[model samples]
Target: MSICKWIAAGTLAVVLSSGTALAQGNLDKLSSFQTTGVTEFTYVEQGGAKAEAIRKTLAGINLPDGFSIDLYAIVPDARHMAVGPQGIVTFVGTRKTEVWSVTDRDKDRAADEVKNFAPSLAKAIPNGPCFSKDGFLYIAEQNRVLVFPAAEFFYESPDVAAFNVIPQGELVPPEEESYNHTARVCKLGPDGKLYISLGQPFNVAPAEKLDKYKKWGIGGIIRVNTDGSDREVYTYGVRNSVGHDFDPETGDLWFTDNQVDGMGDDIPPGELNHQTAMGQHFGHPWFGGGDTRTNEYAGEDVPVEVVMPAVATEAHAADLGMHFYTGKMFPAKYKNAIFSAQHGSWNRTDPIGARVMVTFIDAEGNATMEPFADGWIDENGEYLGRPVDVTQLRDGSILVSDDLAGAIYRISYSAQ
Candidate 1:
């Protein structure tokens, strides 16, 4: 990479990740609209054969001492979730075309109502749903972004107020549209900006496509104002980062990236990256995963300084959605730790990573990971449920979404 090309890319990343760059969303632009005369919203039944099957699957899950798991809701293709700040609703996104709103109307710690959120709007791969501390909700789709004001209250109705943050065909170039590696995940940064991760649509991004990918914020994470202004690519050199979160203590961003495939099952490992600065690049085509260099872009003059992962998880683990555990329900040892889901391997001879993982960060910001929950794979080597994402409830207990089982399971702790 030439100095000029690197500088040109880093310039925008620097400007965005810099502390001085702050969000300027037009809050006044958010207005409530009713989808009157439209009432064909499909609702998921809380009790039935499907729910019983999910409950039976949860019975075989393994967790640590003092922890328990229960079937929270029956959701189809549930990917990532955003528990409403008001404690009235939880918005769940899916790999399909629907985002479901789940509500525990009785405060029973289990969802009572599960229905499509914005059934009137056609969503394309709306897989990530996140909320701001002040009640704004953001959903990251494959090729667009949308927001809802007072989503907690409006989610009860089939038609909630919806507005485009990054309109269709604007989040990424329409010509580069793809279905693979396009499930975007999003979160609100401390600076009140919306940070969305764009997965480059390839096993290893091509050399010719890297420049264009960086320009369009593909294969990297980008931040924009709440109203979708002042867009900038914050992190670069990432390959299909499906999950990330900010450290509540230091405000630093951490993410998990799916590594290169077909390099044998155990050579190039999966990554849990820590980004502490602007324009920081996590090795992608250069280093497949960790220090293992890629076979595609071999012998190339590597230019930018690549940020290695804090922890190189097992290869082919397929680590997906993650969140820092900030709840009070668990023991003090778990505070500030990270809870992430490994969706398990797709093509490995022996499957791995179909469970929830907890990583403890030491005082020096170093991280170590271990299996917090597992046993989702059956005795016959079949996946009972593949965990996708983790989020905390108001009660401090955490909820995990499983797309394989099409359900959300709640993990709460109580002294035995």
Candidate 2:
């Protein structure tokens, strides 16, 4: 079709789809364009208005004083990341089912080399990672854990033949209607066990079903030995916890629980929970976030002692990547802060979160959630990047992985 005719059709389509003639003017203004060099492209307005400078793919990031952030490396489908000894940053990509190992050999704190750490079938959506002292790597797929023996040699693991893959045993008991599910894994716990999160599939099932499933155990954290033994439920009432970590300071286990959706836009915000005791319920189908009841499964009374979240994030924030800031690169106030990446939300009509946030904690372990870094969610509901995970480097710098933009960012601090 001729350029003029193509422009005319585009204008008419826009007008019809918008149910008004308001879009026709903009369409006509963008009707004419030009091409320069073979690799160069440009769009020219018919009214002779100069083209504006294209916005940077990444902008609007806000960090504390003396802190700066930059794109570390370009990674396709990079989702969650784990930092290893000697500045090794490994990311698990769910879409491509590929794990990437990044390192900064030049010591600039940016990943200079990206190597394919592992590859799996399309069904394998790589979730999270934990490392053993023997250099073995533990990664979570959809519903299982795969052990990579001596994963330190990932770039040289010839033909994938040198790596060992092991699947974890199921935690749900036999005859149980519910099954094991989730995308989370924790380092071998203090008990030398690997703690895994089992997410409730449905937001809230019928009371009868809940009663039946509770008898067999469902919706909670499950733990087993590193070799996958002594399987049992650690806690219940968690809807879907995507992030978990063991505190380096207190040796306590901390996790982030995602709230159930389909609730009102601002009712039940997500949760930042700590495992106070075994068999503790953090209020799933009954009392929701902020101790507010959903009234869905009424009369199914939750225990009064059920623990509340240590802190509350934005509603439908899709929180993930709970790592405590024990590194020394930041100010004194951030020494014990818990950092989490809010992956943003799609269930809400407007976006809620898509940035890295920090929760400052005192020596007594009291915490307050506050915005540490933002600018991933825009006023117009556009997300520039979705930060999935944050990892600490040896030098105290931190790396954030954006699954949407397929990029890793390094955040560093220096006093002026």
Candidate 3:
């Protein structure tokens, strides 16, 4: 590669590896609505308004002055985003086993093209994609990881039928292992393995909960070799950790666990935890954060042993995607902070989360949660957009995915 190409590649790599930029959590937009010239985009739903309708961008969001939000991409069931080969923005469609690619070729910086990077298997649902050093893409679907080449083929088409590279590491623990329906793909860190977030399938289980979870493949982070070998359970007792990333500075793995339902609308806030050791458990079903559990699992010393989240969000915020900030666009204080997406809640009497949140980490590695974006949800709990994943661009600007609108918003900074 030429010198300029090398520099561009390095910059893009830094942005992708930057993790998450600081944003807001729980969708609290504290702004007055302007009734004039509000931009609105709508789509026709499949069966009816209640069916799996194609949601579009609406007017209630309150954006900061000088910062404008636009329709970035129109993807089908787009969920998560990662800066993939050639700086292309890649996202996952949960219902299918296909990895969708979004690109901005006109230099307008808006995503204008869409294609599938990899196709799905009969019963698999693609969750996330992570790139390797050798220009390979490891995608996580239902129960396995599919490796694909062409880390930089932007104009060319992707060959999903050719993926055969499997993980080469230890297998996940059989006893606690359950075939998780939604598995997230992530590049293994420090240990050089592929880490998959395996979520528990149920909210509550019987006294002998072993059979329920172990049989279904929920509640843990599993690590295996890139060649699809030597899988091992890194941790257990996790609920649904859809969004997870490793701290580039410390090599510690961090994940956002969604709070369980039926526990009252405003109880037990979702958790952000750090994996300090192997096989560590974080009080699922038995113990919870925010409000302590009164059940048999509660008042016990088990959840206590597991390190509490670096920060505690509002109850039922439904925190999903998380990334650590490693860019220079924002202030230096935000370098160690984490950016997370709060997928709006359905059960809350009034919707709570729908924007990105920032978790500030101190010099000692401690963390505190705060808001970064505050306009996706309106005052009356009306949601304008639901942020799914966060991606940092090559220029340090942050890209947020709104699955509700099938769009991506680019966030940049400029001093007045």
Candidate 4:
């Protein structure tokens, strides 16, 4: 055999056996290439007929008056997004193995390039990406948490510094891991701690599993220091929360909880909850979703006080990623409003969501939600795009990610 063939076989053997550890070793080969400046990189552009088709789809989307939606980039399976400081790059996560880096080098609003961020490390459903103000990028996976120091500067080459914040199987026990509700979303709280959502692995957690679930915070949000210290449950009794954000003004946490299924299609509504303090429980097993009681725990006595949702959305809208609008480009009325994505529903006789919704907060902290952008779901119940997460850009525009269509869209406002 040729020398090159022998080397390739050896490399494959190591990768198949050692996995990520071997992959990390291979990244050393690219260490000599320094990633110093943003201008040095040239990103691949999204154009041609595919871009035109995406544009056509965007034209059908309906936004409020004076607002327009444009194709920001064509990202595959773009589950969640975390824009880097100054919005130099947008890091996107997915339910699959790869995380993407979408860059707009010349500040054109449209992405100049969309490419895999860190191709060296073997990832398991890296669905959540969050960046600190100081330039640290963190990704929350199914059963692990990884931190990439200075990810914005060093993402060009594969030699980016990577460390585990929470090692594999430590986020949740290996025995308790399930295929369901493992799409974890994370964010850096105003308190500077890393908050992660651990969705319980069941529709209605069985009675026997309640104790373990509470202990591990399997159905709740967990917070810890950036270094993974002082881990504790911030809230409990949540069925499955795929999206959450800290209110920029109040520093309070708000999240979207996917309510229990199997209740009649329209009986139990999804929730947008407010957590004022720690240890608060949002009714789950005791009350399946909203005020509807679960069949399993219907007659059981409530163990703790339940905090009702701030806003009760249409049942099975599959509400996900939310953000408080702090951009100046929009009208003053939209300032501090909550913008969220509804990924749409399955198993319902009628389809719902698949668009963006806005929530207005009154002086007394009361929230009222209304549709801000629609038309993703057609009259025949077909989904043109399933919106997953909503994020903001430095240019004061909003970016919405769609996992089904594998695309990210930019929503901007203009008086004209």
TM-score of each model, paired residue for residue: 0.92, 0.79, 0.77, 0.91
Local accuracy of candidate 4 as per-residue lDDT tens digits, 1-416: 11111111111111112223424343234333433222221123476655677788788898889999999987778899999985678999999887889988888898877767766566788999999999999999999998888899878764566777898889999998888999999999999999999999889988898898898899999999999999999999999999999888999999999998888889689999999999999998888778888888888889899999999989999999999999999999999999999999997899999989999999999999999998988778898899999999987899999987778999999999
Stretches > 4 Å off in candidate 4: 1-45
Against the true structure, candidate 2 reaches a TM-score of 0.79
Clashing pairs in 1: none
Tens-place lDDT digits, model 1, residues 238-269? 99999999999999999999999999979789
Candidate 2, backbone clash total: 0
| Among all candidates shown, the one with the greatest lDDT | 1
| Stretches of candidate 1 exceeding 4 Å from the true structure | 1-36
C-alpha lDDT values of all predictions: 0.86, 0.64, 0.61, 0.85
Q: Ranking by TM-score, best first?
A: 1, 4, 2, 3
Off by over 4 Å in 2: 1-55, 93-96, 120-123, 158-181, 206-218
lDDT (tens digit, per residue) of candidate 2 on 300-395: 666546788888778988888778777887888888678889999888888888888888777677878887788887777788789888878777
The local distance difference test score of model 1 is 0.86
Ranking by lDDT: 1, 4, 2, 3
In order, how many clashes per candidate? 0, 0, 39, 0
